[model samples]
Each structure stands twice: as structure tokens, then as C-alpha cells.
Target: MADTLQAGDAAPDFKLPRDGEGFLTLADFKGKKLVLYFYPKDDTSGCTAEAIAFNGLTGDFAAAGTAIVGASPDPVKKHDKFRQKYELSFPLLADESKQMLEAYGVWVEKSMYGRKYMGVERTTFLIGADGRVARTWRKVKVPGHAEEVLAAARQL
Candidate 1:
């Protein structure tokens, strides 16, 4: 695994498929704050709740000059369905190759029922317009996480 990124490190750049069509790149968020969240799967209970919470504060985030994006190993088709079902107002990135997830150090070993597996660490990064990470939340809990991220983005 790559070194875990910390605040003040240059945010890694990436371009990945997004829901609907076309792609989203780190450059797309240049000159603006970005809330990039990595979750384990699409449409799962925790992931869905996190997406909805972020979606619920879309206007506030926009007002703060921030953009919210959720990424997972799921493909574009799955992302589309998830977005539609939740009425998400932001982009859901498809990181099927796990490149972005690894680059950001959110891909790691996880254990459940005493069995180990590789999966996303449910992390969130607040990146400033200058491309530096302003804050990071690892092992994120879904409850009030979007609001927490929004508060950090406002600081950026």
C-alpha cells in the first residue's frame, strides 16, 4: 500500500468514469474545494446514507464553493442506479480499476468475522483549490459525516 496521505500533501490527480457519461478529473475541481469520499460499495446501507447526507447538503456545499464526489470500485452503471435511487445531486465516480483508491491510500485490509479482505477504508479528503489536502477523515463513520466534511470544506 502507498503511504497514507495527510493534510498538506499534494492531492493525487485522477480521471475516472462518472455516472451518466464522460469522465471527471481532478482538474475539473481546480480553483475550488473538493470533498472526495471513498466508500466500500455502491448502494450499500452505509454508502447510501453517506451519499444522501452529502446530497442533502449540496446547496450548502455549493455555497461554500465546494464540490462533493463519491468514489467506489463499482462501475458506471451501478453508480447511475445508485444515484438515481437516492436522487444524489453530485457526481459518483467509478473507480473500478482501484487506481484512485490506492493512490489516495484508502484501499486497505479489512476484517469482518475474523476474515480479512481488501476493501476501501471509508475515507474522505478535503482538498483545497491549490491541490493540497486540507483535511482527511479515515475510518469514517456515516453519521453526520457529510456535515463534518462540509464544515471542513468551508474552512478551506
Candidate 2:
């Protein structure tokens, strides 16, 4: 596996299908900060809360010139339903092949109840306008995370 990315590393490039029937890529946010969050699945409690929190802060994030996007290995159909169910304000990219998740170093072996398996780690990357990572949160705890990322973007 590649070493975990740090604040100064160049963010990996990705182009994936999104919930809104369009594709988004790293270059799309070239001149703005981006919050790229990777989660395990859609509609789960933690994931739902995280999405809603970010959705609620769309205006605040836009004011800071930041864009928010979520990603998961779930298919595009799943993403669409999850977004519509929660009325999510941002796009959720479907990484069915797990390439983007692996490139970001979030796809890994996980242990649950003493059993090990591979899954997506809850992680978030704050990519600066220069295409370098400005911050990263690994093993993320959802509460107040969106606000924290927003604060950082405002600082940027």
C-alpha cells in the first residue's frame, strides 16, 4: 500500500460518475478548495449524518469557495437513491471499482468484531486550490466534521 497522504502531497486525480447524472474530476475544482470525503456505504447512520451535515453547510462552504463531494464504492443507482432520500446538497461520486478509494489510500483491511475484512475507511481530504492536500482526517468521527472542514476552508 502507498504511504498515507499528508498535507503537502498532491491530491490524486479522479473522474467518476456522480449522483446528478454527470462526471466530476479533480480538475473541476482546480481553483477552489475541495472537501473529498470517502465513506463505506450509503444510507447508513454515520454516513447519512455526515452527508446531511455537509449538505446543511452548502451555503457556508460556497461562501468559502469550497466544494464538497462524497465518494463510496456503491454504484450510481445507490448514490442517486441516497442523495434523493436525504435531499443531499452536493454530489456523491460512485466509485464502483474502488480505484479512487484505493488511490486516496482509504480502501484497506478493517476489523470488526475481531474479524478482518476490506472496506472503505471514513476519511476526508481537504485539497487546496493548488491541487495539494491542505489537511486530512483519518478514521473520521462524523460529528462536527463538516464545520471543522469549513473552518479550515475559510482559513484557506
The TM-scores, one per candidate, come to 0.97, 0.97
The Cα error of candidate 2 at residue 113, in Å, is 1.0
Query: What is each predicted model's overall lDDT from 0 to 1?
Result: 0.92, 0.93
User: What lDDT tens digits, residue by residue, belong to model 2 across residues 10-114?
Assistant: 999999999969899999999999999999999999999999999999999999999999999999999999999999989999998989998999999999899
lDDT of 1 by residue, 1-156 (tens): 255688899999999999999999999999999999999999889988898899999999999999899999999999999999988989989999999999999889989999999999999999999989999999999998998888888877
Best by lDDT: 2
Instruction: Give Cα distance to truth, residue 89, candidate 2, Å.
Output: 1.2
**Clash count for each candidate, listed in order shown:** 0, 0
Query: RMSD in Å for candidate 1, one decimal?
Result: 1.0
Model 1: residues with Cα > 4 Å off, grouped in runs: none
